[model samples]
Target: MTTSTQIDTERTDILEMLAKHRHFLRLTVRDLTDEQAGLRTTVSELCLGGLIKHVAAVESNWAGFIVNGPEEAPDFSSMTEEQIAQWGDAFKMLPGETLAGVLAEYEQVAARTDELVRTLPDLSVSQPLPEAPWFEPGGRWTARRTLMHIMTETAQHSGHADIIRESLDGAKSMG
Candidate 1:
């Protein structure tokens, strides 16, 4: 097979996996009202709508990082209390936020990311990791690696959503 064919195949696989996890996450919130989507089912601050919002933001930021490097990212290691609090609040839906709105935004982000995966000149492009206490001092991630991180985050949060859904209404995502 040609190199182009191999790259196309890899892209297809990446998109498929991401879509699958996204489906599970969305499905967990299926039929939930705005209030229910904002409910904290567990001790965790995460809510259904917030999960959607957070995942969308993560994807969007990482996609931008692929093209623009980390210049736009805030320095996590030096964040003030307000910045840290704002980051924590990203896990919950604030007043006036609706499940439908977040869902719509997630769709928009997912669409943009899908197009990015399809049309990126090369998935091997690298970007330095943002300054964060959690990351290695000088780590760099390729576009492909960033996509994998996005997929992992989505899948992990989907599982969290499933547990939250089950706790909220006795609904199980895969059982």
Candidate 2:
């Protein structure tokens, strides 16, 4: 490959890494029934379904910090038990939302990310990172760091999703 081609390949690879882990997480719970997706074990109580939901939520969040602007740090302090339960209610199955439903949302988020990466200049563009509640006051993050964080976060959740899937059934590798 030419130098430019190699760089493009690496860029695609990085983007794929961001999407692939979420894909694996989605697949992990796809075959599980409602009851199965909710099954929990030690070390963590999140079920496959909840993990997937969290993945979708977090993806949109990080995407904002990278592609758009700052993240609106989620507000949970005022949530009632019912609302909190809904956030983590893996098996409860929100109206019109199955595993497939959530995956579709994830895909949209990914599509937006692709557009952002294509249109925006390289991460070295030296723009000031957006402010978020978690960001240290005056903190600045490069576009590269933002993308890397997304990939790392997705990888960790994918592992959790795998374990949750195993507990749900005997499902193994996405391979």
Best by lDDT: 1
What does the lDDT read for residue 33 in candidate 2? 68
| Superposition error at 85 for model 2 (Å) | 7.0
- TM-scores of the models, in the given order? 0.95, 0.73
Reference-based lDDT, each prediction: 0.90, 0.66
Residue by residue across 65-151, what tens digits does model 1's lDDT show? Answer: 988999756667788999998877778889999898999999999999999999999999999999887889899999999999989
Candidate 1 runs further than 4 Å off: none
In terms of lDDT, model 1 sits at 0.90
**Cα displacement (Å) at residue 10, model 1:** 0.5
RMSD of each: 1.4, 4.1
Q: On a 0 to 100 scale, what is the lDDT of residue 160 in model 2?
A: 77
| Deviation of model 2 at 65, angstroms | 1.6
